[model samples]
Target: MRDAGESPLLVAADTFRAAAIEQLETWASRLDIPIVSGRPDGDPAAVVFDAINAANARGNSTVIADTAGRLHTKGHLMDELGKIVRVTGRAREGAPDEVLLVLDGTAGQNAIQQARQFTKDANVTGLVITKLDGTAKGGAVFAIVHELGLPVKYLGVGEKADDLVPMDARAFVDALLPRAA
Candidate 1:
C-alpha cells in the first residue's frame, strides 16, 4: 500500500503478492494482466524450487525473488538472489528463463548494497526506484544509472499506476538541469 504523505508503495513481499493477485483476478472481469501466485512458506529453498516448477507448469515464468528484510541481510540476499537466477536459468525448455527482483531503493546502504551485489554478476534487466518524488537524495539517480551499470526503468512518481513514466534519457536530462527556455 502507499504510505501516507509519500508516493511509493510501502509494501512487504506478502502484501505485494496479495495486491498482484487481486489485480490479476480483477482483470478477468475488467481488462487485467494474467496473474498467479503460490505462497512459498518463507523458505528460501522452497521458494526457489516452486519458482522453477511454476515456470515449468506454464512454459514461461516471471519470478520475483525476495527475502525477509530482517533475516536475509544485505549480503545474504544478494548471494541467494544469484542462486535464484542460476536455478531459473538452468530450467528445461518449459520453465522460465527470466526473473526480475525488485529492491527497496530508499532503504539506505543495505538495499543499495543488495542490489549492487545481485547485479554485479547476474543479469538484471532494469531497476525500478520507488518514492522518486519524495527522496531527499533523488539526485542519486546519477550514481544508480552511471555507477551501478543498470538502467532506471520505472520511477514511482506518484501513488497511482499511471503516475509512472518511462525515463527518457534526453527528457530526463533536460528536466534535471536548469534551462534557459
Candidate 2:
C-alpha cells in the first residue's frame, strides 16, 4: 500500500494463525501493522487481492470470512489472480512489506496446487507443508518450489507445535528422492 504509509496489517489464515498471530501482534505493535484479523471465517484467499489491499488500507487488516470462491469463468479467474498480484507486491503502494501471506499444504492435491498458485501470484516467500510423516510423495514439494519459484520455508511433520521444521532442500532430497546409488 503506497498510501498505506504507516498503517499496514497482517491478515493471516486460521490453521496456523494461533502460532503466528502473537508474532504478528508483537511486530505490528512495533511496525504498526494493525492486528485486525483473528481467524478467517471463510476462504480469505478467495476474496481476490484487491479486497485485501483495500481492507488493509482502511485498517491494518480484516478477517476474511470462510467460504467458497466464484471462479467458474475464465474472466473471473483472471480478475482474481490479477487482484492477488496487485496486493502482494506488483501492485504494492510502496513495496508490500506489510502483510504476511501464509498457506497450509495439509489438505490435498488441490490444496498443494492452490498453495503453488498463491506463491506464484502473491508475495509468498515460503510454504508450510503439514502431516508429512514417514511416507509422502513430497514430489509436490519440488513441484511447488520449482513451479512457483519460491522456497519451502517450513514443513509440518506432525500435529504439534514442535513438529514444525525449517525446510532443508538438500536433506529433503536425500530423504525422499536420494541418489540412486
Candidate 3:
C-alpha cells in the first residue's frame, strides 16, 4: 500500500487476536499511517465498516484491513471472512479492489491448500507470500499459481515494511533456484 503513494488507513479487523491489532497498530505508527480499530474482541465486520467510514471521512485513498487469521478447516471463521467482504462492498462499491491472501512461504504444500480454501471462501484475488527471505524457497508459489490460477501480488522478504516487494517472476525463480557456484 505504501508503494502506491496513497495515504492508507490500516483497519485492525482482527478482533479475535489482541496481538494482531497491536501488531497492526505498531506497523501503522512506524509507517506513519492512520489506523481504525473497534473495541477489543468486537465484530470484525463492524470494524471494517467503521474503517471504511473513517477512510471516506479522512479522505484516505486506501484502507488495508488486517483481518483475523483462521485455519482453512474452520468453516465458521471462513464465513466471517465472507461477511467482511460483503460488508466492504456494501460500504463502498468495489471497495476491496484486491483481496490478497497472505501465505507463509515456509508453509510449502500446506500453503497451497490454504490458498485453495481462502480463494473459495474469501474470494482471494491474489497472494502475498511472506517470510521469503528465510530458508523457505517459496516453491509452493508455483503450486498455488498453477492450481488456483491466482497471481502472486507481493512478497514479504523481511520484517520491515519496505521489505514487501512486488512479485517479479524472473527474480523469484532465480532466487529459488540459484546456479551452482
Candidate 4:
C-alpha cells in the first residue's frame, strides 16, 4: 500500500484469539502503519468501528481489520460478523469497500463450504488463499471459485507481507497443472 501511495490503518479486532492483537501490532510496527486495538476479549465490532474513526482522523486511506477466525458451523460467530458489517456501515456509509475472506489453501473441499457461509454472512467480495508455499497444491482453488463465484484476489505464498501477491489466474492454473515435458 505504501508503494501505491495509500495509507492503511490496521485493526486488531481478533480479540478472541490469544496474541492476535500482539501479532498485528508487530506487523503494524514493522510496516510503520498505524493501528487501533481493543481490550482483550473486548468486542471485535467495536474495535473495527474505532479503527475506522481513527483512520479518518489520521488521514489514512484505508482500514484493514483482521477479524477473529470463525467457523461456518458457529451461528453466533457468523452473527457477530454480520454485526460488524452493520456497525461498519454505521461508522461510514459504503465503508469496508471490500470484504476478503482468507482461506487455508490446504483445506481442499472444506474451503468451499467455509467460503459459502462467509460469503453469505459477511458479503465476502473476494478470497485470499494462504499457505500455498506448503505441500498443498491448492487444487481446491478452482472448486472455491466455481462454487462461490467470488474472485480469488490474492495468494499467500509465504510468511512475509510481500508473500501476499495479487492473483494471476493463468499463472495459478499453470502451477496447479504443469504441462508435460
Candidate 5:
C-alpha cells in the first residue's frame, strides 16, 4: 500500500488473542501506519465498526482489519465472522470490497475445505496463501483455485512486511513446474 500511495489504517480486531493486537501494533509502528484497536477482549464487530469510523475521520482511504482466526468447524466463530461482514456493510455501503482468507501453504487439502467454509460464512472473495517460503511447495494453491474457483490474491513468503507479494498466475505456475534437467 505504501508503494501504491494508499493511506491504510490497520485495525486489530483479533480480540481473542492479546498477542494478535500487539503483533499488529508492532507492524504498524514499524511501517509508520495508523492503527485503531479496542479492548483485548472486546467484540470483534465493534472494533471493526470503530475502525471504519476512524478511517473516515483520519482520511484513510483503506481499512485493513485483522480478524481472529477460527477453525472452520467452530460454528459460533463462523457466525462471528458473518456478523463482522454484516457490520462492515452496515457501516459503509458496499464495504469490505474484498474478503480474503489466509490459508497456510502447507495445509494441503485441509486448506481447500477451510476455504469452502470461510467463503460460505465470511463471503471470502480471495485467498492469501501464507508460509510459502517453508518446505511446503504450496501445491494446494492449484487445488484451491481449481476447486473453490477463488483467486489467490497474495502470498506471504516471509516474515517481513514486504514479503507479502501480490499474486501472479503466470509466475506462480512457472515456479510450480519442475525445471528440465
Candidate 6:
C-alpha cells in the first residue's frame, strides 16, 4: 500500500498461531510501517477493532488486519472468521472493503475446494496465489476464478514483501504458457 501512496497500518490479529505476531512485527519493522497488536492469546477481533480506532486517530488511509490462517474444513475456525468480520463492521461501517483469500499455487484441485468453502464462509472478494516462484504453475487460479467469479488481485511471486505484484492477465498467461522462441 505504501508503494501506492496510501498510508497503511498493519494489525496483527492472528493471535492463535505461535510467532504470528512476531512475524508480522518483523515485516512492519523492516518496512518502517506502523502496526497495532494485542497481548499474546488476546482476542483477534478486539485487536482489529483497536487497529481501526488507531487508524482513525492517526489519519491512516488503510488498515490491513491479518487474521489467523484457518483451514476451511474447520467449522469452529470458520465461525471465528465470521466473528472477526462482524466485529470489523462494528468498528467501522462498510469496512473491510476487500476480503482476500491466499492460496498455495500448488494446491491444484484442493485449492478449488478451499476457495469454495472460504468464499461461502467469508465472502472472499479476491484471491492471492502464493508459492508461484517454485514449480507451481497456479493453474487452479483459472478454475477458482471461474467457479467463484472473483478476480485475483495479486500474485505472491516470492517471500519478500515486495514480491507481491498486481495481477496482469497477459503477463500471467505468458508466464504460465510461454511462447516459442
lDDT of each: 0.50, 0.50, 0.90, 0.91, 0.90, 0.91
Model 5 lDDT on a 0 to 1 scale: 0.90
**Model 4: per-residue Cα lDDT over 1-181, one tens digit each:** 7889999999999999999999999999989998898879999999999889888888999999999999989999999999999899989899779999999999998888898898899999999999999888888878878877889999999999899999999998888889999
lDDT of 5 by residue, 1-181 (tens): 8679899999999999859999999999999999998788999999999999888888999999999989999999999999999999988899989899999988998987899999999999999989988776688878778887999999898999889999987877767785787
TM-score of decoy 4: 0.97
Please say which candidate is ahead in lDDT: 3 or 6. 6
Cα lDDT, model 5, residue 158 = 94
Q: After superposition, how far is residue 148 of candidate 5 from its true place, in Å?
A: 2.3
Clashing pairs in 5: none
What's the TM for model 5?
0.96
Clashes of each: 1, 9, 0, 0, 0, 0
Task: Name the best candidate (by TM-score).
Answer: 4
- Which parts of model 2 have CA positions greater than 4 angstroms off? 1-112, 178-181
List where candidate 3 sits over 4 angstroms from the true fold. 1-3
List ranges where model 4 is wrong by over 4 Å: none
Better of 1 and 5 by lDDT: 5
- Scanning candidate 6 in windows of ten residues, the lowest lDDT window is 79-88
What is the RMSD, in Å, between candidate 2 and the native fold over all Cα? 8.4
Output the worst ten-in-a-row residue range by lDDT, candidate 3. 1-10
